[model samples]
Target: MQSLDLRRSGAGHAILVRGGRMARLVLSAALLAPLGACGIPYGTGSRVTLSEAPPSAQSTPSEGIMQALTCMRDSHTLNRIRFGIAVHSDGTGKSSYGYEGATGSFLPQGTAAIWASEAVIRAGGLSMNYYELNTERALRQFGGSSLDTALATQQQTRVPNFIISTAFTALDFIGGPSMDIRAGGIGPYYNVRGASLEVSAEMYRPGDRMTMAISSLNRQVFYRDAGIGGGRLFGKGKGELVTGTIGFTDQQRLQEATRDVIALAVADVLASMPVVPDDCRQMVENLKAAHKARVNEDRPQEKPAHGSRARRDDLPAQSPAPRIPAEQGPASGTIANPDKARRNQR
Candidate 1:
């Protein structure tokens, strides 16, 4: 009897365990079924769709350079002077700081070179010899005897009329004394910060070894903020205060400011160069249109208003009307004049 009782107890425990497991399996399936039906993916992979990326913050600087070039070309002051740019140097030899404690040299070498080259090309009065710098560096690397022998034996290389050099002389940041206070569920906060970058640029005639033009430009970029907000409800209230600053330590803004100054400096230097008559007005206009198109492309497309027809601009252009042969009469099944047909019927 005791053995039979023990066997029965063991069977009951097994049944309970099996019932729990079945319930758990059903619950798991119920939980996962909705996800499977919804087509939610599992695992580590992700799906991405191709898209047109928005323009970088550098667009403003590029546009500034373009506008400056256009203006110079329009003024008939820029001549197609052959020139080359040297690597820009940080004369200050000091590191600059941005938001989040980011640090970098006062002058970025790559940026300076690119900005100068672009400005020169866009202004339309300058011919750029891209290999000028490479050739110079190669010659320098060969050193004394080899350089002399190469120069003596090989044909002379074309020298640029002017070599452009730039330096970042100074960078200064000021401000950060900000205050915010909240009382009676209301408060206003204000902050202001400013930064200035000074750049010096010079154009040298390689043959004459003379400085043709020099420009020192100081550009100041600033940030400002002031705001007030408060909320109250049902004899209970919450207060908040916030302070914000802009332009200080903002890398993009700094770069834009630097480009603006560079454009101004380059324009000033190019003003002295000889100007040849070249029709670049159309080119400038085309450039402007391209810039506008890019801007429009990057803008978030607005949805059409409800119940409105599709915009005309979105429609395909209408084709011209097909030419009709004068000798061909109306089709056999078509009436030339509906009014005549109606009169006949009447």
Candidate 2:
């Protein structure tokens, strides 16, 4: 009786152990099931999506200038007009973000001027002596004799017919009141910001030193956003949770707006010029061809020759089938033409 009781107790212990192991296995399986849906491939490799880099900021201005030049070329209104660009200034005389002090150390002096020069050159209707302008200070430092000698040596040192200048006349920034709303434990905050800029430009004939054409442009940019925050019961857990969100305001937008304004001003100023520079037209053609080549290069290559059904039809026709000679054969090499063999035997 004592041995039977001990045996029964051992059996019960084994049963309990088995039940515990089974429960643990089921729990592990439940936990691991979600991992299968994660889409992660087993092994050492990682997944990535490949793409090309974005184009440069200058691309916009360059493309805009190209289009304007194309229009001018088509209409046959382009002519070779010599011109020079001087440093643009903030004529407003008010302190702004970039222009802070009297010395004007913060402002970008040639931003618009350089764009205009490039536009004129790319249009193929204007001429600018970049080499002369670049070397002017150095030549002057060598004295009047050295300057005269340098000018005499140069084959082309023609004076500019007109000088172009630009000025930033106004800048304004406005901000809307920040508003926060809450409903049922959820809250959202909203606000708006705006910036306005004004620019003026003038074209002056060198001979008379008088303004031939004047133009002004005003541009404004705005940014707005609403940020949301809320809390809810997730999986019966009570814990602090934070989620990150992307903002819409990009600082580069301001620079882009400035470039756009410069491009427009350049187009307007060039329109009033008597003749477009000849070199600018050639540059336009070159830029167009380069853009075409770049676009073609980025396009996917043609499919393989065998993969294309259209090319299969374009292939040369195959030659006629070769003729096969007649043959006779047996285990002992019996001849098919037995009559000829019999004649030979006779």
Candidate 3:
């Protein structure tokens, strides 16, 4: 093999570098380096950080969404009914965070309010945006020129069939900043951090704002911060070595958790209402039946255990084709089992 050529313009000289201790150390480190997608070992710093895949905005339906959607689908009158949602207070009352106050806590008041409005709209229910005053002003201005009282009758504010109001009930800190070390005191050093968020939603008639159903839901979000590192010390004397550590962090984004709980609470309220149209009754039943069938299909197929035989009763129910007696062949459709026939007669 050709020795490496070293060129030094300042010294105006070139040296033939033979493979020695330094060269061997470089080679070993290169071999131990982490590989990229193309299997090429790449240079890295002392620390590397990787991110977990966040939740998808649109994917498989969540439990809350499924239940709410199912009921909305069955009702079919959701579009005809309007919902007024207002969640304007901090009910949790826990007064602190690293960044802000209670009302401005991790789970803010606006989160519950907006999530409720979105849930109602997404589930095929008509909802009014009562929060923005500018939009209301614009609407009023647009309808103002309908003359005066004459136009008032033609355009008027819509009444909601149901009103949804929510308040944060509780926020509790769950576990810890616990630590663990392994692999000769150099494995993962991790801690568990979680917070439980609870909120309640009240649905009511808009006429008197009379409360109908209140659904309170709680969700606990758990996350962890962990780090691990390992390195090899090879060579009798001193050689080039690289020690690297990596961090795997799962952050607690409360918005998603809050959205989930809000969706479930809204579903509960909608499910309590018996406002489903009579025409939608059959369709709802069919939808439910199809959902059940899908669930069954997704379940894993079961088989008899090893060294075990299935009994006659263990098999699925199936009616065997009955054979006719030669005397009564073709003409008689009666079952051949006399006992079964007698039982049927009785």
Predicted model with the maximum lDDT: 3
Candidate ranking under TM-score, highest first, comes to: 3, 2, 1
RMSD of each: 29.2, 34.5, 21.5
Q: Residue 26, candidate 1: how far off, in angstroms?
A: 23
Tens digits of per-residue lDDT, candidate 1, 139-207, equal 767777778677646434645678887778888886756867667556776777877778877888886
Residue runs of model 3 more than 4 Å from their true location after superposition: 1-64, 94-104, 138-157, 182-185, 229-244, 276-346
* Candidate 3: tens digits of C-alpha lDDT, residues 165-267: 8777888888877876667435767889888877788888876767777766666678888888656555678855657678898977775667666766676
**Candidate with the greatest TM-score versus the true structure:** 3
lDDT assessment of candidate 1: 0.61
Worst 10 residues of 2 by lDDT: 304-313
Q: Per-prediction TM-score, please?
A: 0.50, 0.51, 0.52
Worst 10 residues of 3 by lDDT: 304-313
lDDT of each: 0.61, 0.59, 0.62
Q: Which candidate do you rate higher for TM-score, 2 or 3? A: 3
lDDT value for candidate 2?
0.59
Better of 1 and 2 by TM-score: 2
Among all windows of ten consecutive residues in candidate 1, which has the lowest summed lDDT? 304-313
